[model samples]
Target: MSDQEIPAREPSWQSRRLLSDRLDWNLLRTFLVIGEEKSISRAAARLFLTQSAVSQSLKRLEEQLECALILRRGPRFDLSPAGEEVLRLAEEIYGNVSRLAATAKNPQDDVVGKVRILTISQVQSDLYDDFLIQLHRDHPRVELEIEVMRSADIQSSLNQKTATIGLGLCRFPQTKLERRRLLRQRYAFFCGKRHRLFGQRRLPLEALQGENFVSFTSDQLGGNLSPLTMFRDQQGFTGKIVASSSSFEEIRRLIIAGYGVGCLPEHLVDIDLHNGLIWRLPPAEGVVDVDVFLMWNREQRMNHAETVFLDSFRRLLEAAGEE
Candidate 1:
């Protein structure tokens, strides 16, 4: 055959791999890392991948989408509008895929793998201490890792597969994770001993008006109504929050330090209430109530250890219900 007359060969399977036909899980992760970092080099460091590899992944993603996902400018890069949208959708898809994969994996009998549970500091303080004490006593073979993070982090932890379970005030959105509402959380408005409301048998809601208040941040409000929102809707709540924070510990200390009247979960401040360190605001109709949930990503094929752990957790939650 003449040098240029030979028939052209078909593209190699590797070259013909269709991005649309198969999802590249790593591509979504790479997109998220790069979007968060805004620099491929930085993302590469975070992902433990070479800059060149990161670049290749981006190229694949862009080629598959037939659009520029990122705009390179000098030493920096930013996602285009489309890229931002992709990132959002990719995150959702990644979460779903992870859940599917997790459920499909065969369980190991020994169950030696680490299990991560995400929760808030207060939940840990009020409930998990007893649970963990018993867990260790009964299941010494199962190693447990607990992460005390915010509610948002708890959601993200389960969403990102960083934690196998999440225990928090709010239930996760529709996902593969099964959420069981464990108990109702009650909040009490309270103030230091020096406050007028402290000595009263039951302070009127309006009486709280004009009183300086310390409160949780909007995010920390979780699914419950914000204190400010409660005050606006309820009569007799004339309190003014001079400071706000999401940290339960900080809020506790602030009230003790005489910052302002604050609301806290009863379990969190039960001891303080008894010690006279803080006094509850008189009960009012339609007070804020929160639902606490225990969420776990279930495996399609649960190992013996995983099954046992889940059962133990369910039992603990059930016992909490009795209290």
Candidate 2:
């Protein structure tokens, strides 16, 4: 119970570079490569090292951090929560380092930084494509890193300042973020080739009542796809709700597989319509349209590259409006 019996405490932040002095930075680089390749052998191949060497480096990192970075069992390979965080930080570090190296190689007054854009899956935007092409042509020094994610996640990234910009469905207003409509995607019901209602033309509203339906996981009242929910209600089709997913691709696949009638963005299914995989159902005018917006946290300080890209996108949008 004496003061000398107490264990020595670890040094705080006052011990400058104490922890950093002992950490091997190469292990972090090795771990980053491992995460990207998702295989120790592949990472080793890329690093021009042996598989055992790469594995040992990962083990060393885990030991130093006091947590496992990855879960490897049988044929499965995945990141642990701690691993995910480390990987994220590693990626940010690499991205910034890459930008710095590029700037050093080609010194210029040009915008030179990384723009991180988080967006929802499968966004069909001609304007966005044009903007990317133009940005590359105008500011080759600026790098763009895009990641696909859920709409809600996109907002979180924007609000948290992790993402420089975002493209997604706006479920509710976030006062901290500035938003502008990028595109409006229209939804229409479709039946699969094997469905009983396939190829049916101009069916009355009452015909859809009591019919089974597959839909987006967010297609509920006050949800991301609330417009679809409102339209389904208007038609008196209560939606038996056979299955659901957040992914539009899965919903389309299930509808094509004849699980139930489902809705998809009309622009996204032209190939399916042409290939006879699915036929458009009732409501010739189409049901509801969801607005996807280009959003960012204007209150946050943006790097030169991010600010340049945002202005470029706004200019493109304005020119489109003028046309």
**Tens-place lDDT digits, model 2, residues 163-188:** 67899998688988888888988888
Native-to-model Cα distance after best TM-score fit, residue 10 in candidate 2, in Å? 10
Tens digit of per-residue lDDT, candidate 1, span 1-323: 32112233444566567745765778878987787577888889989999999988987776656566777665666677778898887766665554443343334433433455677666634465676688677656665667786676576556555456777756335465677775677777778887666678756666766777787775233343354365444555465667877688988888888888877777778788788898877555434666667877653334444566667778877776732
The most accurate candidate by TM-score is 2
- Candidate 1 regions with alpha-carbon error over 4 angstroms: 1-78, 81-109, 124-131, 171-176, 194-197, 200-202, 219-222, 225-228, 236-238, 284-286, 298-305, 315-323
Sliding window of 10 residues with minimal summed lDDT for model 2: 1-10
CA-lDDT, candidates in order: 0.67, 0.80
TM-score of model number 1: 0.63
Error of 1 at 28 (Å): 9.3
